[model samples]
Target: TESSTAQWANEDCDTQKLPFVCRRAGSVSVPAECPHEAQKPGKDIIAPGFPIHGIPCEYMLAVDAKSLVHLEILALEANPNIDFLEIYEGTMGHNLLANLTGTISNPAIYITKSANVMRVN
Candidate 1:
């Protein structure tokens, strides 16, 4: 229903060819150290050894008590067969939020549903 009042629906990813944006190299600087836990906001989290062999890494993001954390995936590129990113609800991996693989066509956003803590692995 491609009309003035179209509703949102899921479609086949393999069939659709949507336009995307690409950033030029050297536009953004990669951080030197990857922290295991994060409390401050606006810190960019990059996969260990990105664009190459990405080693296994885990990170946690926590906000002040009662405040929720919002994670935004600005860019995600990975080998769907061998790479993945898992997000958890709290300080542990018991509650799975999202498991992402393959290349992301657009920016993805995830908000804390029940708490102010989030873990990424």
Candidate 2:
């Protein structure tokens, strides 16, 4: 049985082919709010509502255009599948520096290839 976007339905046993519906563009939009924006050399950024159930959030770190940004993962603990932290070099469209998930016991350091900006989400 077919249902609306906000609802689901179940149908009895039947042998039938269902036509697929396709869309050209996307519809859903998630509001990404970056509470932590840092420019310092050694800054610590904790995920919003960290160590607890985190809400949808974003974090952006920008440094001087000529100076590269270095990121160190001092500690990390999260569900690998559901929660993740993505590090990008320039913008979100640029090179992906690292895709971090799960818990990391040892400290990990990353230096951006580009010097302008780094995004964390």
Candidate 3:
């Protein structure tokens, strides 16, 4: 069930009438050969093998616990229908903070809520 605060609870789907979101896979596939890396602030996270399609990379960013991370997307070039960049709030990526795709005109900003760690995939 869904609460008045807009949070989901453990309940049968038929018990409540709530709107849900779904995603369908497109023609593009997830890159099989992905290289993982751990990064600190100030390092640029770029997609491996730039200009090549079907290439994806994962990165973990850790910072001082007392500080929050500020992520600025300098540039993004991809087909919005297929490619995407997802930013999660923690190492496990249980909470999604941002999903970016397609061409970006200006720099987009994303900051941590409380955790000093974030995952990019």
Clashes of 2: 0
Report clashes for each candidate as comma-separated counts.
0, 0, 0
- Could you tell me which 10 consecutive residues in candidate 1 have the lowest summed lDDT? 1-10
lDDT score, candidate 2: 0.63
Ten residues in a row with the worst lDDT in model 2? 1-10
**Of the pair 1 and 2, which is ahead by TM-score?**
1
Cα-based lDDT for every prediction = 0.73, 0.63, 0.70
lDDT per residue for candidate 3 within 1-121, as digits (tens), equals 1222222234445876656543332323322355554665686665544544447777777788898778889888888868888999878888899988899879989888988887888
Stretches > 4 Å off in candidate 2:
1-39
Q: Candidate 1: where is the Cα deviation over 4 Å?
A: 1-24, 31-33, 36-39
**What is residue 87's positional error in candidate 1, in angstroms?**
0.5
Query: Over the stretch 12-78, how does candidate 2's per-residue lDDT look in tens digits?
Result: 3355444533332333222233454354667566554433336656556677779887888988887
Winning model by lDDT: 1
TM-score: which is higher, 1 or 3?
A: 1
Best by TM-score: 1
